[model samples]
Target: MSATDWIHSFDRFDGRKGIKPGLERMEAMLLLLGQPHRDLRFVHVAGTNGKGSTCAFLASVLEQAGYRVGLYTSPYLSAFGDRMRIGGCNITDDALDALVDRVKPVVEEVAATVHGRPTEFEVITLLSILFYAQERVDFVVWETGLGGRLDATNVVTPLLSLITNVGRDHEAILGQGIERIAVEKAGIIKPGVPVLTTAKGVALDVIERTAREQGAPCYAADRDFSAKRTAYGLDGQSFDWRGIGDHHVALRIRLLGPHQIDNAALALAACVQLRRMGVAITGEAMQAGLKSAAWPGRLEIVSQSPLTLLDGAHNPEGAAALAAALKELLPNRRLIFVIGILADKAIPDVLAPLTELAAHVIVTRPDMDRAAQTSDVADAVRTLAPTTPVETMDRVSSALYRATVLAMEQRGAVICTGSLYMISEARAVLVP
Candidate 1:
């Protein structure tokens, strides 16, 4: 099939399935595909936040260490091909079409069987495993689509498992409270595998208990290894990571946000674990990868003059991190915000942090069926930041236009955040 045809077919398949969170269908599909996931080695990562950044850092470091690395992340910012990459380069359109073509027959056969049909995430995940195996990749850095235990990507028994941190996300599916959420996230822990996490408090206790039960050696971020920020700015941040058997001072990373230092530490700790598991990772490669790591749509600066930035702060924890970054980086400066979020997220919690930083707020809806209504978000803003000037724009482009004008007039920075969907559209508009 042509790439266009494949895209259309895949889009149709994608529309058919919604959030089927379990391993039965996935296991059946992978079994039919010769259990390719078992043959491949992976560095599996799961968490509410920082999974993408942590995966990016790990992949870059593995590639720098002269290994053929396969990196798989979800919810692509711009292109579907961005989900599957090797050595920092995206999978080609031709390759994607071919992969879909190869997997369609198996998918159809499974759909007709008692096991039932697999979801889009499951198909994409199986395809990634097949591609990584066919390409003879040395290691695959895999990011879970949702909560770990039941996520399609959890099929692999990874060499090292890294949970960046646990937070209240997908509450409906994963359950309420940090402990319940931590159990789901800790589901990725494999027996006898060394799991590294930056999670603290009740979440940490849950993970530790789960790891102990599974006979997995768990490395807590602050207890086992940690990163201390030495310098930070809008440009970049430098930190000291005290990792297992290695102490790297002044490790520089291009990604912005204070939370990223913890992410870098998790990545470093994962690398250290990978080394213990007989993977060749040098000190030089670790530093080089830290220097080159970057993930888009998370505190990303797209425009300079008006100082427009995009962040995917879809939840309370993420909002707090974004707010902290703004306070540290742009303290006492005028800040304007263009926000759009999904209907399912906590609106008040997401708005509270942005409202504190925003002199004026423009509420809008992203081009997604699940996006929260503009009026709903506006109401939340009024309740959270009563005195803050608010405007409602139905369209993202119009919201950006209004925010840009307000930022220019106030000599302030324009922040577009609340959801990854909005950030994706904003990046396509502003960066393009």
Candidate 2:
């Protein structure tokens, strides 16, 4: 089948319509596909916020260290190809088509036999593992799609389990509180494997206990690995690692915000652990990889004429971090914001932090079924920032244009955030 045809076939497997627990189906499918996940070593990353960034950094560092790396991340910004990368390049269309075709019959059989209709994420993840194995990847960095325990990617027993940070996301599936979420994410920790985590607060306690209970060595952030910021600029932020040794190196990461510094440090710490496990990574390679790592839609600046910043700050914590970064970068200038969000998120919580930094806000919806209404988002912003002007637009492109015009007229900055889906849509329109 053609690539577009294969994608269209899987698109029908949406709406959380068919999801099952246990790895039996995945295991059977992999076995039929020659068990590709077993051909390479893995570093599985699971968390709410920083999993994509952390996976990108780790894979880049490994590649710099002279290993062929495969990186699998989720919720692609553009094409489905963005979800799978081999040696820093997306999988070729030919490879994708072959893998999808090979797995189609097996997926259909599983769906028929066990009443398991695999979701789009499940199908794509299985394809990634199979393709990575076929290519003989030296190392694979896998990010969990949702909660770690029943996540499709959890079938692999990774060399190291890394949890970047835990927050209240996907509450209906992962659980409501921070501790519960931590437990779900900690499910990736395999027995005798070292689990590295940057979680703090009650979540930290939960993760520590889970690691200990599972007989996994726990490397908690601040206790086993830590980072302290030394400097920050538009160029990037510089930080020193304490537990990993006196590696006084600077990074020129394209991703903005102080949170990225922490994310980079977490990836560095994971590298140190991998080296201790005999991965052969060097200090020079680590420096280069950290500086070169780029995860788009996380405070990505697309334009300089009116200074447009695109960030995927979908939740409250992320939104707060984005606001702080904008304030730090443009202390004297006001901001015009074009924002959109998913219907499931708490609109007030997501908009409150961003509204504090906005001179005016334009609300819009992403081209997704789950997107929140633009009018509702506008009303919420008005409730928070009564004096700030608010406008509602039907599409992200229109909202982005209006915000840019306003920013140019006022000599201010335009910030696009709220949902990754929205950021992806806006990026395609504005950047092009």
Candidate 3:
């Protein structure tokens, strides 16, 4: 089978339309493939929102320092091969096809075990590890596909572990509380491997206790390190990183938002820790890396005429962060918003904060298996923001077009948000 076809074939093993968290199948796959992760250094990252951005920042810094960094992030913003990258480039199709050809039989073998069939994520994790090993990358910054304890990527012990922050997300599978989610994410902490986190309050308590129990050094944000925003705008932001090392005067990032300052600080703290671990990184590289790092679909600006922005704010914490950023950045401006959401999220909670900022909203559904209906999303918006005008559109392209036109007429900004899948759909229409 063609590699693209093989990747698409994973839909058949969707596992109850969700994640089946465990390491048995992953372990069996590793044993059969001869443990490709051995001799490879890793920087495993886990969190509710900032995992991808943090990975991007860390990878870019390492790359700037001249290390061939391998980054593995989930739920690709564009294409399937976007999941695995070395030096910020996606694996070529020929490379992916060859790797899949070698692993397909092993995947089938793992499928027959008492551990049962490996899910798509499990196989993808295996493939990423193999690709990284074969390519001889300097370091792999691995992001968990789900909660960390049983995530396939968690099988590798890392040079360090980072939890960007914890909040209520994937509650059905990760359990209900923020602390529960924090515990699951902190599972990536290995014995004696230092841990850094931006989590606060109860989640901070959980992360600290877990790291203490694991005999890992914990660098908690606000306790060990803190960042103060120097300046911020739609283009980018600058912050002063102060903690866990010498103070950085002004670390600039293109990611956007105050929450991103925390993400960048977490990444900077990691760079300091990596330097202590014998990795050769310079101050110039850190500055340049933070300045140049780009993560698609997180407050990504795709257009300038009506000042359109796209963010993957699908959950409560994420939506709150986006809302807070817009409130801080735009103040009195009520934006025209085009939003699409997944069927299984806490719909009202996700819509509440964002709808508060909307002058007009067009609800739509992304082309994904579990996308919530546009009518359902519009109903949620109406309930949340009684004064805001809401409309339903089945197609993201149409929704974006309408939002843009209304934004221009009203002399307001446009925000395309809801989820990463939603932003991907909007990108196809808006970016080109």
Number of clashes recorded per candidate: 0, 0, 0
Per-model CA lDDT versus the true structure: 0.88, 0.84, 0.89
lDDT of 3 by residue, 139-227 (tens): 99999988899888889999999998898988988888998888899899999999999998998899889999999999988878889
Q: lDDT per residue, candidate 1, 45-125, as tens digits?
A: 999999999999999999899999999998889887788999888899878778888888888888788867776677788
TM-score for each prediction?
A: 0.96, 0.96, 0.97
* lDDT per residue (tens digit) for residues 348-398 in model 2: 998998999899899999988889988888889989999999999988888
Clashes of 2: 0
lDDT of 2 at 304: 91
TM-score between model 2 and native: 0.96
What does each candidate score in C-alpha RMSD?
2.0, 1.8, 1.3
Candidate 2 lDDT: 0.84
Better model by lDDT: candidate 1 vs candidate 3: 3
| Inter-residue clash pairs, candidate 3 | none
Error of 3 at 381 (Å): 1.0
